[model samples]
Target: MRNFALLAAGALSLAAVATVAQGVEDPYIWLEEIEGTRALDQVKAWNKSTEELLAQDPKLASYQSRARAILDDEQQIATPDRIMGDLVANLWRDAKNPRGIWRVSPLAAYRAGKPAWRTIIDVDALGKSEKQSWVWHGADCLAPAYTRCLVSLSPGGTDADVVREFDLSSGKFVDGGFVVPESKNTAAWVDADTLLLVGDFGPDSLTASGYGRIAKLWKRGTPLSAATTVLEGTKTDVSVSPFARQDGDRRWTFLTRGKTFWTSDVSLLTKDGKVVKTPLPEDASFEDIIDGRLIAKLQSPLTVGGTTLPEGAIVAYGLADIEAGRSVAPELVMAPTKTQAIEEVAASENILWVKALDDVSGKLFALRRSDDGRWTQAATALPDNSTVRLLETAGKSDTAFAIVEGMLTPPTLYAVTASGTPAKVQSLPAKFDAATMTVEQKFATSKDGTRIPYFLVRKKGVSGAVPSLIHAYGGFRAAQTPGYLTGQPYRAGPLGMFWVEEGNAYVLANIRGGGEYGPEWHKSVLRENRQKSFDDLHAVAEDLIRTGVSAKGKIGISGRSNGGVLVGAALTQRPDLYSAVISGSPLHDMKRYSKLLAGASWVGEYGDPDVAGDWAFMSKYSPYQQLKPGVKYPAVFFYSSTKDDRVHPGHARKMAARLNEYGNRFYFHEYLEGGHSVGADHAEDAHRAALLMAYLKRELGGKK
Candidate 1:
């Protein structure tokens, strides 16, 4: 069909170019090249197919039109600000307000200007003992109306006691603390007066155990009540849906552990201690239980709307037979054959929302269950050159709040109804007008003959060569879509810091290492081909310098997590290109990263060190192991969280230690709390943002 023809034409074009170049070997010779012309053409073809596919779909076209109209209408409301960073998880309107929507960041709680956020409570201020070293660890609000907020604070000093219930509205600590002794606690609110706490029960298990269960449900307001075990296991992944009200005399909670995805044994826990275990059809993964009786599951080799999903084969299921105790054979919900994987799931009463992607862009879709019990497909169209993230859902209105942005557009919060047009809720205030902003698309030829796509964002009418901070995350299947950053203090606020933004930040899209182009894209750059990612980034940076967007000594680079690996790779490969580098919670030491919490889950993305085949490929780019002595890298800033259970702090710590020992200039800071994000709460997020902005200002030659 058209896709095959396009690929053939692209190959022919590559062959022609190779013939003209004389130095090239074959059409595929340029596949390893970063930003080579062939690569750019391939990406363009992929994007073209996506656009054609969307255009052909009526559902997608309608949604796109509606989304575009909303953006066009909201453009006049507020001048978009630069979004410096965002809170990973924060408090926002659980439901839409009759007046207007409200979103409150815990970090923004301490901002000088905000006053609508009246001090519901301050746990540290009313503390009985520890002052200088106290950290808020866990927080959650009760359902229906989240009027009551509960927080837990642990003293940093010798005291291992964790204060469980500190009520925000009451402005006092609840009496008779639920102490976990020396164990860290992860709690979930079950009801108004109940909580599910997960931690270790014994001392030796607390100190040396890799996995801890001790899952117990405890009543909050009750005085030191005995804990009830809902389930017990060494390895357990628990997720609970908010209490649902079904037909008279029935309340249901869904629970799952091992073999839920592959084996599909999900238990429906009733208030009366009745556990109804439902098994799904073979090869189906139980996604979520919709409403009460309808269970959503995914089956393999699934096709939806005539598109084959790329990652693996999958079909969706909605089990209606409750008495059968097993999911009915699944029907095809959506099978986008080109997509590498689909991870996150969000749902409303009538629809199941899924975020998907091919090798070029991230796409979202919703499957609506009709009155006939059949599912109808709807493609959720977001703006071009931007990415959309679903925030929260409201039951009554069936509306969702989402954060939307693109390379040129500033991030804005929007209210999206199920079938109607989206409404703009709030936007970050722009310090500079959009008229003053200019973006240009450029291409760079990589080590091979491949052409890579890149973008440049700078202030209009600002002449001469400018100092620029170049950012990229050229790993994984994640694409760097264009979006707006409003209130980005470091990039825009202080002036003089002319930032050059690029979508090529994620350059592994088609080079066989990212899902953006599909499994083929990822497979191309896996193992020995990993160097293609580094080379792609280098080509972009070099193109910036060659094009006079930035000078060599005046340019800086940054990324976080896996992107941190990009920073290290760039420093090792092209130390002369950047003036400074900033990496946050980086996975610099790839060899030992698999042993960390959740790190083992990513071995499919990052190769396993234990495997001889992988080590040969990984050793070449592994930042921690590849550090060379007497080689001065760019001034680097490394950040890590001591409580970051995901990527171990050892990666950052070892990188800093080796860099410092070798007399390389670097700064390292490890925050004690904040988990892997290093911003457990809103206040901490704002502080982190301010610190990052300050660091960027100092490093990028902005006024301090």
Candidate 2:
């Protein structure tokens, strides 16, 4: 959704495709043609200019090396994507194998630091043989045996992917097996010869959000069109996808209809292939089947058979009772407090893993339910003040993997079970120089007096106002955590290694519209209130200046996708606040957001531009419409991928066109591939990040 995630994820103002009905004519509308000759020509022209300005720098190679060292570091843990009974599966990518390979290793040996490897699919080889630029999306394997799988592969890194059934044991794609043509598709294994699928059946089969609207159950030896329709949500629905979960002897199949970005409707798909509405509330998210019960996270307060679960509470309902249509009360598993937010929920055979953030710091807990239907939790002994994410979870056993890292700590992998015993599996070999850097948590008072939190990292003992960069994504319930600026390539993009090393203090703004404190924190700045997120960002920048960290025009702001909105707003709404901006795959043309692919899905977050009231507030901050002539703006470096099917590259193209028309100077680049992310591979990611870094350094003055 780069609304590129982590999509609190994921967009800018009401996302949509556009006809440019905003009274004013859009001269750059032709750029929305995506791959049109004229559009690509303009893109090439801008890309040429960009290379001269950024890539031509003598230090460009160094910037790229720093990025590759983090992205393609061979020493990086081979964190398993799934832990099979005695095997661990992962996708490995590097300088040589940029397209990556899906391979597996024995679990016992992997835990002990020795992995006897087995290759499943060599994506680089497959792509070469098939004459395609293949990118690994993921693989959904059948349960228990784990020998059969529906492997998804994307061409040119687009959201749409071609899914095929492969025999894991045979190390080959099954002859005449299930194959879904290139489309944003979903295929879940229901049984050995059956599947619950959502795909591009034909015209009008997809929703306005550019996702499948029909869910069907397809059996072996049947034409895909003959598959029985399981559920049909409206074309206006955000999306509709099939769901299947296997837990020991039980199987839970359901249909999930995403009504909006935040709320959805779930219905059970029974063994007899009948679709029945589940008793669970529509807004409640069915996370996974934990133990013998179906676990759900309540977005709003839900009343279940006499008891009401508070918003942001996790509860469990027995699968049998749910399937039998019996009146069943839910048991609360994890209830979030004001300062606590549930980050992720995963499960093993007996253990339910709940990764929560307590005051913006990572906290992992292993919650196990007793036979009496009571739940008890044990907090894992992972280092506090870091970001702890569950790297892999399995329904087969209690063995789960977690990764822990912080502003100064490199990511360390761990193996944990229901007993809350976490064994250090592998620790990141390299560490950022913490001795020279100082990390601190600071709060900026927003317009409404809310204390917005942010993390600042810089060289130790450096006094006075210095050049700096502020990065934030203040939309979607995505939380901004304390990330290693100088170590992790993800947190600060490529700037993590170079920018901080050059003495620029990097700031991460934990503004509203993020899950820092929970859903309420995000709800505070939605739609009409979205400007609060902008106000909150400006507040942080103002706080940095007022706190003697930097002066106006000395600081640079950057964000992508939804963060794209953040930087776009910062540029258009508060031009005097910063000197430079880096916005990638952004949502600038808010007026036409929904008309674009996936824009309709984000209406709940940004509001619908088609609706008058929604657009009334949306148009006010819609960056595209806010551009004015003669107003000095920080030179913005806008980068987007032409293959991006999520947030259209047109948003960036149009914004740049408008800026140029308004006599403002900006740098722009659009990759022929790379989808909505940095790029299709690390090389591309490094180059994209390098360009942004070069722009930031030049704008803010490279050295102290």
Candidate 3:
């Protein structure tokens, strides 16, 4: 097998400099120029060629059979939305009570632990709302008591003024409401009574440049007169910490911002009205802040340690001078030297907990302050090799919870003791028993000899080929690993279907583009090595078919965001390998993606299309650019939101139009308000999951 590195080099060399010089053309232009008839013909030709290749490759045939077996097993239960919902419910249950759900926005809370203190709020009598959809954002909680909690409600999803607060104690809503008349408000809690809201001020308030000033802080009850300005407008970048903390006698807020392309700022806002901002070291961008003082800053041109980081070394940071209030220059700590990534960080006054990624597996570490005030580290926990997402923690308890799952293992919640022992706290409803389910790991050699890892989950008694769904995301150094299973209601129920109950789904951890194997793995397929990513996905598909998990005609693929881009590239490059594809809020037109908001910042990962060398590497797999003249792709579903300022919704809109014009069967659903996520409320999420699963069932052929 050729090494992935060698193959990436070879692929990069194949594209010509002249062709790469075209730069990023407006995707709208491509949509307008490419005649539907001509595009359809090109898609057909590509699909036919790929089918012929698979037919000739016996290995590919066998892998497809294995994939089918996994998908076809009849004994497994079906429940799509059940997974996510149950997972959330279980986490709430383990928190003991009064827990709230937090998400990515207001980066401060996300880092500080958006959900914040576990027992600080109320959690009883919680139920999903009917009118609102995509409830992930636009919600806040007030800690009325340990058993009494009040949750802010947004019925018009995340973008409208719709505001109502719920009393978890009595499972009813309180009457006082605040609705912004001219703009939409997304709420965040600064304290029980204070809200930090982000929203457009109104058309009249917008600048001449078509940009509007979105306020970052607003007091709920106190008059604006008493409030302080945290962030003034859109021009000044701001992000909140995931969690908040008190240092010495002051309450501190940590955030990162960029005033220009070359310089980024990380600052600490003290409660006493003083802002301490530090410029990132020249040529470096701050990724995240782990502990309050330990910062994860990436230098221009990101590089994983030449080797993968040792197990438990995923989170890297530069120590700052505690007393001096500044980062120590030229110092790197917890740097991984191999295929690993620091995923999460949790700390107390005396110790810090860090989670590291090794391929698709996870490891945890405990670092403590020494007598001399230095840090000492040691591996404290090693759960069964699987995918893990940290759930919650009790302050200074040294105890934490996580959701763990594997290909065959349904996701389940587990509590980790201070001693690091994992105790199963709750098991998702088992429509199928683990004893009857078979889960295994298999590797496929990439075009270059790099082994790509994948997992197969199926029923034990099932025989022969079955329809299968293969999920993958081979970009942005993200990894897909095993974890606890979400119930069928969350996974398939809302969709009027169920999991194995519906059929089988496979997860592929493709190589060269994820943190699974470390920085080296990601580098092998980044930018110029982009083709390697598509090939890695292709290799996994072939391996599944060869193993008899599924037949060529029974397979489907799904991904979101960058993962969505992976699906786009694969569909364009190897449509024969899948019967359907789901690309959600995907960054498909890579050549021009960076031009979007903050897109320029990611050049470190995706490469600059304007540069000759990089463009040569990107053009080969740039999904939109690679669409052929005569090919028929499997039915594809493209979903995005109009308010998604992060990755422009234009990507999906253009791709959908292009595919439709080409006479291909595809579905396009754009939400008008939910921001980046198409769903805004619980009901919205349930509906979206249903739609996605329904589409998969229709294309993949589920429980008849």
Candidate 4:
């Protein structure tokens, strides 16, 4: 409702800006009205232009067909995900079930090549029956028993979801069970009969970032309104949420008060409803409890209890020692190097698996505590230069599943044990022919002499003047690793297969403002240093051109979310470097972004625009504000979703509308659903991918 109101004002302001140029008024402010009839009609008109333009391209039809086929392919590996106690679950979507179906299989069946899956919930059927465009968010089942669960369903893939209590045994929604209506909410089970919830609780319940500020304990058979408030945070804070961590028979409930996007204050919720403050660095994260010890990963150097711990280090302290009010010495777990960073941490019953990145490649390590209270670490032997992700870990055993893959390699799942060798569980069949494609790790020097690493994928012995696509995301500590595309079964590496195999190339830039190196690397390009990331990207592009991999009018760049802003900045600042730009679900209007949906939360990463000092640098890189009337910008396309509640669709909408006013040759496509991504269903994703590839081909002169 806040966004809609802003859109209405922006629309009126856009109309007024053309006549009354009194102050800095937006000319396309009308487009911000996400679901307004007038704004949607305008979007329809612009979409028609894009449709007509793409219709004339000969490759569009073939690209769309190929994309749809890839997405809808039945042979695509059903990625095994463990949920509840023993059931291995998977959410599957194909041509037959576009909305996807949540299905479960036994552990034995899952480990085998083919799983005998039984449908737990058909999202498409539920959506049709309810006459709503319900998108599957996911389900959170209680540990151990795992009979009853909380299922989250979103309308058109928005961040806001309706949470309903579900009976896993009966494969049906629980009657008169706990249900939370659509709002940005989070919940965790305190017990089968109780839940800790954080969400919109009527007036004054949300923060400036539009996140929940109140935490409540709702017991079974009680109305949500009557739920007892256990904790509360100020409206200026980012959010407050509760999470229950179970270690064997011990269950620890915690409430995290997010003061900012990167920092939080953690408190332990006791059985008697008392809040006990945990002493730790505010920037440090409470990872998980292992061996009756609380673990923390520090983002900044901190002096805690007379000892200083460096940034990018994981440390642990005894939970009993803290409770007993005794002086405790923190145990050093892992400290990353200047060129390395911890990516993720997964804990089994006894061992802790740490996923770290040395440079930009993946490294897996396992840590275990011995009988003498000494911790030992061992590196897990997986494939080199491949991204390794922990699929799931059981609380009762020292067992987990890990999936490893690279840009050209297919995803292979492995059953990881505590001390033994990780055994192979499943490997996806080759989706694309990578025999001719070779991947090279290269580096480009930034303006400050920082050597930025990037991956280049191209055909062997074929080099000069190829149609290349450069990709990057340089913000929010989110490191862009070398994965097999953001790829799915049918939507396999179409870029690798359709584009690269068809004589094109792809380059992934690991620029600053990302966790490619570590917290230092990310912080180096934050706030005022944001331009360094843009500079780093340009350096990569310049390197590609200098190395003869691509030419000025032959390269295209694509990025979504933060990367959207990255490409958007590139298109504006260095328009001559690339021929095409695909900016999806982007943040182009930085000046007013803080006022938009969930935009205020990012002030920690991107400083507040209201601050004059912050605005000076932000305005320089803001793509929407940087557009000039006479600039010869290349074929730039902006795509977004109307259902996006996290980043807000208005960012793309206003930018495209602004581009139109400049008489620039650009393309705009906003899906009616699918939140902040390509879309909710495979068909929508296929169309989105097809549109991007087709546009890139048309602009960069790819083969028909």
For model 4, state the Cα shift of residue 128 in Å. Answer: 1.0
Number of colliding residue pairs in each model? 53, 19, 118, 5
Worst 10 residues of 1 by lDDT: 79-88
For residues 1-704, what per-residue lDDT tens digits would candidate 3 score against the true structure?
11211222222222222233666344243322222444334333333332332244333333333323323333222111111111222122112221224211221222233222222123232323343232332234432122222234333233334445554445455545333332333444445555554445545433222233343455566644444556543443322222233322233444444333334455554444344665444334443333445545342233344633233232334334532465443333465535566676655334566677765677776665544545566764545677777655433345555666664455555556556676665544543456756677788888988888886666677777787766677766666665433322222222212335444654555556766765456667766677887788888878778877778988877777777778898989888888888788788887777666445656666777878888887887778877765698877777666556566666765575455445566655556555665554333344455456655665677421
Q: Write the per-residue lDDT of candidate 2 for residues 300-348, one digit (tens) a residue.
A: 8877668777888899887777678887787899898888999789888
> Better model by TM-score, 1 or 2?
2
Query: Which candidate achieves the best lDDT against the true structure?
Result: 2
Give the number of colliding residue pairs in candidate 1: 53
Model 2 TM-score (2 dp): 0.95
Stretches off by above 4 angstroms in model 2 are: 1-24, 304-307, 394-397, 486-492, 702-704
lDDT of each: 0.50, 0.82, 0.52, 0.81
What TM-score does candidate 3 reach? 0.66
- Please tell me which model should have the higher lDDT, number 3 or number 4: 4
lDDT of 1: 0.50
Q: Quick one: ranking by TM-score, best first?
A: 2, 4, 3, 1
lDDT at 402, model 1? 59
Clashing pairs in model 4? 10-29, 11-29, 11-30, 70-490, 71-490
Candidate 2 residue 605 C-alpha distance from true site, Å? 0.7
